[model samples]
Target: MDVEYFDYDNYTADIDSNLTTEGTLNLYSASSSSTYALVAVNIIICVLGLAGNSLVIWICGWKMKTTVITIWYISLAISNFLFCALLPFEVVYMITSHWPFGEGLCKLASSALFLNMHSSVFLLVLISTDRCIMVLFPVWSHNHRKVGKAFGAVILMWVLSAFLTVPSLMYRKTTVHGSVIQCHTDYGVRHKAVVLTRFICGFLIPILMIVFCCSVLAIKLRSLTHKSTKPYKIMAALILSFFACWVPYHTFVLLEIDFKKHNLEVIKTGLKVGATLAAANSFLSPVLYVFIGNDFKKTLRRSLSSRIEDALAEDIRTALR
Candidate 1:
């Protein structure tokens, strides 16, 4: 829902043709409050997300021994970090309603946003699937799940995410409407196809897979009376957080494909709010790891980095056993 990803082709021409000073002032006046609020929220998310995810990357990437779980956490942190790094451009765009970064950065920024979407969800699916395998066939998982295989899967996830983001690179354009420049996607005839592809590949299929894996893990744990439920609880929290953050963003995006049926202002506002929720998600994982990784008392006493390590170490060992 960054301005770079909005489809403004339909209205750019209208703005060009009907540019009265009064109308411009009215438009600015009406939207300025919300725009400023969004800018503030974006800045906050960018700062916190960068800090939190950087800690996660450093702790998981360097401080801990390399393992399959570390690989997943590091990859996920990298994706979120990259997205947060690019969010300032979006903040500037939202404030000025202009894109001075030229066409290439426009495409890159837009593509990066979608790349985060695809990679994050795909990684979640992989994590869930890995958990399921560990739960149902601990011996097989312990024997076959290697750090090299996790690296291979991470590579494949990035490649697939990049492939899916090609449409953003192709369609994102910078256009001049009066003196202001805008960065937006111009999908032309393929808008529906592109949006549908994002919904299905980025959200629907991956979420379903996550749900199925979690369900299986839940049922398996339920049957084993002696097994601790902490791992299942942790995985459940992750899946639920993911679903909560992404559902609104994807719902508004899907609605946008046929935005005519809904109120236009409502759609735009929904998109903005949904986008804010999505942005907040980049920071939520590290916080979740800090607080939910251990009990409240232990988390309070432990160093932040050690908390993350301990959180993963305990549950990961339990799952593999």
Candidate 2:
């Protein structure tokens, strides 16, 4: 919506007295009211994701026998966990509806954003390819698909992802909209250009390749109809889960541009809701690990549940004192 929505004319009815020509125009718009909800949700997510991801790292790195595939997924999960740790700032931004964090963070946040943008798809693609190789050439996989090779592949994937997302870092900025300062990337009309580029380069292209690779693997691996093939099902779920989470987010981003031109009440409400649902995606990734862990996590979690509950109870009791 550019900065017009916060201008004297549109907002004069609600906040005429707050206006200041010389002072910073506080950009707190109606949208900034998601503060309390954002704060609570963010804290919960960060705590859970940090604890869960730490558990995953401990399990994969120390407890389990080292496999190349385990090493790859562990890295991906750790990255996701770290990125979610930064959710507190986003929560703060949503709650206070102010960018009090400053311009440097605003730019830095864009770089952090690149991690999420590339990590999910690339990891999924890697998993699919890894499976395909395992299925199609079972004997060849043992000799070749070593931990070192998986590590090399992950490095290459990240380099390509980082190269594509460098543009986002370049475009992001903290802009004053009113009493609420917000961080976003603005390429003006060139936004559409970036969207198309991302669709082709970031999303559409990778997704198609993943599907194709999986289909080939599934067909070739029909002979080895054993329990080991279940990982592909989990991988399939991950790919679709990624799509389910992100499509709405990207759709809302486009809808926001439209919302600027016409602030219809219905559209605004839809955008607001969509924005919340999109935020939920950030928290959903760690949950996906449970679905993949068929027997191991369930048994371990059940055994530990009581002791963990006792510890939690003790912490609450101490806090109350």
Candidate 3:
């Protein structure tokens, strides 16, 4: 997209030399009123997402066995939980229609929000690929896909994610303008570092991983017979749902980039809707993921009836004793 710049003197002082406010600068003409409404919706999504994901954490944490899927869910729940923790700040930012969190919080909130926000997509990609390996090559999965190894992979993901997001940590700050402050990334040139980071960690890598893994799984299921089709159907549904849910989001990112290039109004609507759909990803997974692969489904089903009964029975016996 060709770039356009507007003079942002109202929001611009000596301090805000590089900063630009949308309305003050007439930056692409996004309505503040509409942005506030989406902010409200985002808050609701965050709350529901937090509650459901927290339940996933509780169910998986104390009860489930250490397996590849469980490890991934733990990674997921932690990220979502932290993501929710940062919601009120953004909610306040939106409700007031300004950035009230201040300069330090601008960096802190942006880092916390995005570190976990974007990391989740990559982690999920890792999970899908991990499961595909399990299905396509059981022996290899058994040999290599242990909980300890999964932990290592998660740690690496965080390190890489942090590295990718260094620009946000370094340049993110609050832009104060005529009694209003807003949190934003303060990249001057939108350099290769920022652009590539946005593309790779945010969009390209995770989507490719998901698409490839799901494609492989689809092929594997096609190669199976009628007797094996039932479980594969459910697995296929779960996998397909993941892809379906993410499409709106990924498409939105592409559309946003396109719109930013052309400054198209129509694509902006899709982009907004797509981002909302993406935010809902945190909530959707807890339900879909409760049954995706071998270990999680088996362990969840196994624990469903017996583990609780046994625990209660043990408690009763203890009381009698």
Candidate 4:
């Protein structure tokens, strides 16, 4: 996710010139209304994501039984929650065009965003693949799947995500661009390589794996004696929401790699909008659970916490039988 920095065209020039006081004031004065609008949207997403994901963490982590499914949901919610928690720093930078936090935090905040991306996608892949395996080999799954193993998988995913986020940590820094302290990634000559790696490793491969798992699950579920579509619906909702939220952001990120060839204004607008959409994904899973879990109408009559519990309580094994 590209930090919504100042207009890159003048940004570079201003920095190169070692912005004079007049230039700094002019840059501050030139702030656009659309930037504020995007900040507003980000604030809204931050609040909702914190609330929704906190609820999921509470219910799944504390109220529900520790099953493999609950473990997956908890890990996902934790990632989203941590990312949302850092939004205030980003929001401050977006509004003031300055990073008040020091360089250490600048790096951490930037890396955390990618950490959430990698961890979330990896968890989704794990969920889909786990479900596929359960459907294909119920006996083996029943015999072997344990909460400890689920915890182990979650740990491995987070470690791998942290490993992938090293680029962000290495490249993200706070540079005094005139009066403004800007926190941005400086990939130097390797910008394209880093962006492409993120797209392929972070987005492309995981999405393909998810699609394949979902396809296999769909086909296998069709031949089962009991034809309940609830699990399929839940998985489909998760996959679709992931695709919808991420595709735009990745599209803009790729476009940005060759931004010199494209309209800078259009690319900037797309990036701001794309980033807002991506941030909104943090809360989407909890909303999906509430609306798509069990019988919606019946769940609505219960307490919200109970409804969420019911959602997490869904067992894929039951559907197989």
Candidate 5:
């Protein structure tokens, strides 16, 4: 969802306005209104995601009592906030099709994006693991799910994310394309390996692990004959929504690596749509948490922080009982 999309070779576009004497394509187009529309959508997403996630951080980090679950949610919200913060840079670059931020900023932005994504997904995995353990081994979970442990795990997740994001940081660069300066990654000789590695590590492994943990939790609940299947249902929905958002992005990434020449229009459109969907996932998390954790209609009256505090209190009471 980050500059990974820009890991392709020298890109050429059909929009004709920014052509130089040497005939290179600019990032934006004066003629292509669709690009502007996509940029508009990104801007909206940026504002909403930033505002919503800030509230989440305030509530989860400051208002709520520390718990394993709250720790995980805090980590998730932080990732969402950081990711949304970088969208404005992307918006400007997309609008003018120019990289005015210089090489250092470009690398930093790209690295931050990848870091957020990797951290976000891994945190989900940790949440799922914690939920599974809580359900299956309640006593052990109660004894062992300490806030310090969760904090340590979150720190490890960030370390892993930062380490994995090295490729983007190393490869992202600014180059002059025709008359316009463009920022993108040059995957060069390691393109296929990098693409496959990212797909497997960034998407496949986490999802598979999530699905496994959720499935095990579901079966355990079923065997116990629990009447309220709402938690399981919400977990399923969360995983499904994740797959829906990311599958297209990863699929298009793989296709773009190989079929970049075959379907120019489709590839370009898919890239735009995929990035939007992926970025939109940030704001969607807080919504999903609110809906799944509380009575959606009832929570509407109170502010988001109040609603989150109420829902988290409910969760703690449930866990204790």
Candidate 6:
């Protein structure tokens, strides 16, 4: 038995099919449109995410004193910045499917993408865990959860994420196929294992940890004497936003394994849509988690200009002195 297939070199599974000319043309057209849309959305997300996360890093790192919460936010912002900065390369690659950036750069880009993604998720897990601990055992958390510990946790997460992304560096390549050099991972015999590992460790396990922590936080908040539950509500919103944005991505990631048995156009469209949603998560995080409070927004607005002016005055005073 012979099978004919169309190859989508980046992130899609092998398609085994014998299709009519019209069907193939439709698939190609659909894929092209989806790729264009995905790239466009990624560009938008890149701009907004970079700006948003940059502000977050500045605010949390410079304007405020270091704390456990600020450390977590800064870590998240740094990862998001790296992810957003790398998005332009993806846009270029998607537009031309021709890898002009050499194989080493291709591997680096792929590895960084996964590294940032996993790091972001793990940071979210850390934040959730910290909040849960604070709610459940305020005295213990107050005494034990220091900024230094948060920094250590962030460093550990980055090391773990790098280790997880080693597969990307090993498997990724820019292969010339029919005059088009495509950048993609060629996992070979490890394809299924890689996919399963990513789904389990990257998505499922972290999300489970987040959910458990959030649940405990919620229960503790409900049992408290204070009727105000604003903190819990904010945390819930953050978790819900993350799940909404990433569930599609992880779902399509698993489904791509069986994409040969599915409709090509549907699978491709779903994958693009999922990627856009997941990318948008980086842009949304700063607003949802850090800037949602009215007091925070007002303080930022009021302080930015005054802070700049004050710094300039201080510089002049030092010069005069």
Looking at candidate 2, what is the lDDT of residue 230? 41
- Weakest ten-residue segment in model 2 by summed lDDT: 1-10
Q: Candidate 4 regions off by >4 Å?
A: 1-30, 293-301, 315-321
Quote each prediction's TM-score. Answer: 0.89, 0.74, 0.71, 0.89, 0.88, 0.81
lDDT digits (tens) for residues 1-321 of candidate 4:
233222232222233243343222121222666777777788888898899899999998788777888888889999999989998887777778788899998888767668888999999999998888888998998889888999999999999999888988987777686687867666666667777888899999999999899899889878978767766676778778878988988897788766557876677677667777877888888888888845678767888877777766765445445
Best by TM-score: 1
Q: Model 2 TM-score?
A: 0.74
Q: For model 1, which pairs clash?
A: none
Please, what are the lDDT tens digits per residue for candidate 2 over residues 136-207? 777887677677777888889878877877766676667776686666555555655665666567677788
Better of 1 and 3 by lDDT: 1
Which ten residues in a row are the worst by lDDT in model 4?
21-30
lDDT of 6 at 255: 71
Among all windows of 10 consecutive residues in model 5, the one with the lowest summed lDDT is 1-10
Instruction: Please give the distance, in angstroms, between residue 181's alpha carbon in candidate 1 and its true position after superposition.
Output: 2.0
On lDDT, the stronger of 2 and 3 is: 2
Query: What do the candidate models score in CA lDDT, each in turn?
Result: 0.76, 0.58, 0.57, 0.76, 0.72, 0.66
Q: After superposition, how far is residue 31 of candidate 2 from its true place, in Å?
A: 6.0
Model 4 TM-score on a 0 to 1 scale: 0.89
Candidate 6, position 78, lDDT: 92
Better of 5 and 6 by lDDT: 5
- Which stretches of candidate 6 lie above 4 Å from their native place? 1-7, 10-31, 177-179, 289-321
Question: Clash pairs of candidate 6?
Answer: none
Model 6's number of clashes is 0
RMSD of each: 3.5, 9.2, 8.3, 3.7, 3.5, 7.6
